[model samples]
Target chain A: MNNIEIKDLSKKYAGFLLDKISFNVPSGAIVGLIGENGAGKTTTIKSILNIINSEGTVKILGKDSKAHEKEIKKDLGVVLDDSFLSAYLTPKHINSVMKDFYQTWDENKYNDLLKQFGLPTDKLVKDFSSGMKMKLKIATAISHNPKILILDEPTSGLDPVVRSEILDIFRKYIEEDETRSILLSTHITTDLEHISDYIVFIDKGKIVLNVPTLELLEEYGVAKCTKEEFSKINEKDYVSYKKGKYQYEVLINDKNSFKKKYGITSIDKPSIDDIMLFYIKGER
Target chain B: MIKGLLKKDLYNLASYKTSLIIIVIFCGMAIIGTDAIYWGSVVIGIIVGMISLSTFSYDEMAKSNRYILTLPVTRKEIVLEKYILAIGATILGSLLGFVLTLLIGNIMNYVRPDNVIDINIDTLLATTIGGLFGVSLIQAIQIPSIFKWGAEKGRIQMFIVLFVLALIGSGVGFLIKESGLSVDIAKLESVLKNFGLFLLILLSFIIYFISYKISYKIYKNKEE
Candidate 1:
């Protein structure tokens, strides 16, 4: 079962538009929304949360998002990169306040997370380091034992140690409950490679690719060939190509099929970042 | 859900506890020995009532409105919580002011027997209710403006609104004077003396209700 089903969700701003976008976060899977800055990742997340008024439909846990927003939200845990309850509140204050919002709020779990994260209960959130603040946010989000987690750039601006620690927390969160799901958006593709089961790539307000992470990493490849050899390859077989001084780097969906068809075998495994770069900057 | 929102705001405002206590004490001390001791309640009431609206600034500072929408609370509940906080603060502030004025006035009377200031219960009650009404009017105008704009921009817009309201009031008064309106000072004073406190409290509630409706309308479809 899909935890979130967003269909043709669109939002229009003064100079930008989130074109018709559709994706799903299946139960027990991590769906990472990967895109560059201003590429509609945050807008898509906002649309799912109903924080913005957008066109099209969003279904969360089988209920219409708009119709059952409050009900759906009870089971949703959200963390935004730049937004939280308040910067002035301490961890203790947050625990006190959150208990009133969720009947399922586990103060012991929250306090345990805070202790594990080394976050001071009395210190104001504004005074904490970015890493500490993010840990606090994640701790707050998961303390209620929410069914789904929606995080926007949760790992952005954090150092590798903190980022990996956070990723481990997410991993443990899912491992604890097989029914739980996570949909996180990040430009840091490497983090998604480690945790995300599926990748939904968006570029310039449109979804360019959405596929399983293993398929993207294991099936997709970059073929470097001479200019003359590149001319021999059919455009239909490759997704996109980047031209270089020495050769042409073509992105293909299937390396094995391309090798069989073209009899060329210099295909390199493409990273999520490489695939993203090729799609955004490469020629059609 | 509103309880959670209120607690969040109350915690945010708790940082002002020391400042608020200092200000209240200062106001009480400054007015305790004076004949115009009644102004203490008005001053304290206005200060406390106005400070409650700073919760909007706190929300804006954190950009928590968007985060709040993700909670299991409707836009109506979010808007209603603000009104509850604002109205609760206004009433609490007025009550504090009334009690402090009475307490300080009696203390001063005991301290300076020769210069006893008459702390009239009715007058203090009227001033407290009148102070509440005045603050409610400002809050009524300010809250909707804040919802339409933002905390920072809304404050500026509210001042402009207040300016226009002031100008309108002056214009109406000038027109009345120029039209040679017959004065019924004694009758008007009698009516005010009888029902002024009740009218002020009733008007405060009515204005707050209208302000809440306007705020809800602005916030219902607002994007973050």
Candidate 2:
């Protein structure tokens, strides 16, 4: 079952518009939203949370996000990339304050997480390093035992070790409950490859690609060929291509089919970042 | 949920406890030998009452409003929490001011028996209430402006509005003086002395209510 179902979601700003974007986060799945900056990733998450007014519909846990915002929010744990509760509040103060907002707030769990993450309970959040602040935010968000965690760039500026530690936390969170889901938005596509069950790539306020992670990683490939060999390939077989000085690099969705059709067995496995670059910078 | 919001603001304000104590002590010492003692309570009342609105600055400092909207609280509750904090602070500040003024005056009088400053309970009450009315009016106008703009821009906007209001007040006073309006100074003083406190308290509540409504209207459709 889908924890969230967004249909034709649209928001318009002064010079930008989030076009009719649609996606879903299924139960027990991590749906990673990947995009460049100002590509509607944050806007889409904001719309789903009802923080911004937008056209179309977002149903969280089988209820309309706007029509039943307060009720739906009870089951949602959200982390904004640049926004949080006051920086003046320590983790202890946050615990006290958050308990009043969530009936199921787990103080012990929060404390344990703080200790686990080595975050000082008394030190002000403003004094924390970026990684420490992010850990605290994640801890607070999950302390309520929310069914769905919607996070925006939870590991944006962290080092590799901290990022891996955070990814482990997410992995363990999903392993802990089969009903819980996560809709994580990040430009760190490699992290998504490890944790996200599905990938939804957005570019310039529109969803460019949405598919299962396994399919995208396994089926998509980069075909490098000589300039003369590139001329014989059908454009329909490939998604996009980048012409190099002496050859052409094409992104093909069905690597096996392309191999059989063109007798070319030199298709290289493409990373999520590679695929993203092909879609964004490659010629159509 | 509002309790959560209040707790957050209160904790933010708690950071000002040291500054608040220092200011009060300094203000108290400054008024020790001065006959303009009534200004002590008024200044304290205004200071404390105005501090409550700084919660907006704290929220802006962390860009917490967007995160706040993600919680279970509704927009109406968010706006209501600010009014509750502002009004609550105003009332508390007024009482604190009144009690401190009396306490300080009596202590000073006991210390120097010859220069005994008369502490009139009635005048103290009037001054505190008048101070409250002034603060309520400023907050009433300021909160809506803050909601329309952000904390920084909203502050500048509020000052401009208050400046305009002061100009209008001066113009009305000028017109009354130039027109040589037949004024009964004694009767006017008598009316003000008798019912002015009641009128000021009533006006404070009325302005606060109107301000709350306008703030809600501005915040209802606001994006953040």
Candidate 3:
């Protein structure tokens, strides 16, 4: 079952356009939406939540985002980077307030997360560090046992140890329910390297690639060779190429087949970051 | 959903700790100022209006307003909560005014009988009702503009609203002087009696409801 299905998602700003984007996060899959800043990642997430007036149909848990928006959202947890808690509210105040928002608010889980995150129940959120605030937001998101989680740069500004812990929490969150899914958007491709089952590369509002992470790892490779050697390889075989002062690195969709045909030996598996850089900035 | 939104706003409002100071200021003014008993409801009304509008500033203070939309509530519910908060603030303000008037009047009676001011219950009722009407009128104009432009931008609109209302008032006063039956307290009371207090309450609510509808419409289409 698909937990989220966004079809023909389009939003226009004064100078930028989020062209018709279509993708889905199947049940139990982590789909990472990777795009540079101003690449419409936030806009796409906002459109999915109906937070912005966008032209598209977003289906969450098989329900329309607009007509069934309320019901659909009851089970959807969303966290945004800038939308941290108010400075005056303590964790205790947040608990009471969230109790009103969710019918199945789990007090025990919230307290446990607060304890684990090293957050004081009585202290104001404003007094917490940026990393602490991020943890608090994630804690709130998971406390309700959401069926779907949509996070925009949820791990930004956190230390490596904390980011890893948050990722572990996400892993446990998904493990709790097989049908639960997550759509996480971030430029930190390393975070998605291990967790994301699918990678959707978006650049300039258009989806450049939507493939399983395993498929991306298995099918894509970067061939580092001399400029003369790179020139010999068919332009049709490589998706993109980057020219350094010393060497040329060409990216190919199918390394195994290209190797057999071109006899090029220096082929390494392309990381999600490499693929993103090549797609967004590499030469034709 | 409206309850949840209101709970969040109410919590935020209380945490601000500014409401207490505003109330204290109102009390201070009431105790020392002349005709303070009569102006209690008006002061309270303004306090409520300011607090209710302050919620928007808080919501916009951070991108928390955007965060809130990700919750299960509709944009309509969020807007509805603001109206509810406004109503709550109005009641709180008006009651504070009324209670202080009585307490201050009674205190003056005991401490200095020579300085005691007798505040009529009928006048109090009329002012409370009038205060609610005045606040309702201000909100009806202010809320829609706030929804269209945020709190910062709406500040300019707020001044413009006050200016327009003043202009309208002076224009009406000129019209009355030009072709008038004698306008006095007796005439006003007679007109009020004929128009009916219940009718005024109903009219004010009707205008408030329209304002809420307009605010919701503006907020629904708004992009964060």
DockQ, per-model, please? Answer: 0.91, 0.87, 0.68
Candidate 3 chain A worst ten-residue window by lDDT = A81-90
Considering the two chains of model 1, state its CAPRI-style docking category.
high
lDDT by residue (A225-273, candidate 2, tens digit) is 9888889999799999999988799999999999999987778999999
Model 1 residue runs over 4 Å out of place are B176-183
Q: What TM-score does structure 3 among the candidates reach?
A: 0.94
Candidate 1 on B48-102: residue-level lDDT in tens?
9999999999999999999999999999999999899888898899999999999
- Candidate 3 Cα lDDT to native: 0.85
Q: Write the per-residue lDDT of candidate 2 for residues B1-224, one digit (tens) a residue.
A: 99999999999999999999999999899779698788788989999999999999999989999999988899999999999999999999988889898999999999989999988898889888989999999999999999999889999999999999999999999999999998899998998888999889999999999999999999998987
Tell me the native contact fraction for each prediction.
0.89, 0.86, 0.67
Ranking by DockQ: 1, 2, 3
- Top TM-score: which candidate number? 1
Model 1, residue B99: distance off in Å is 1.3
lDDT of 1 by residue, A156-247 (tens): 99999999999999999999999999999999999998999999999989999999999999999999999998999888999999999999
Task: Give candidate 2's error at residue A40 in angstroms.
Answer: 1.0
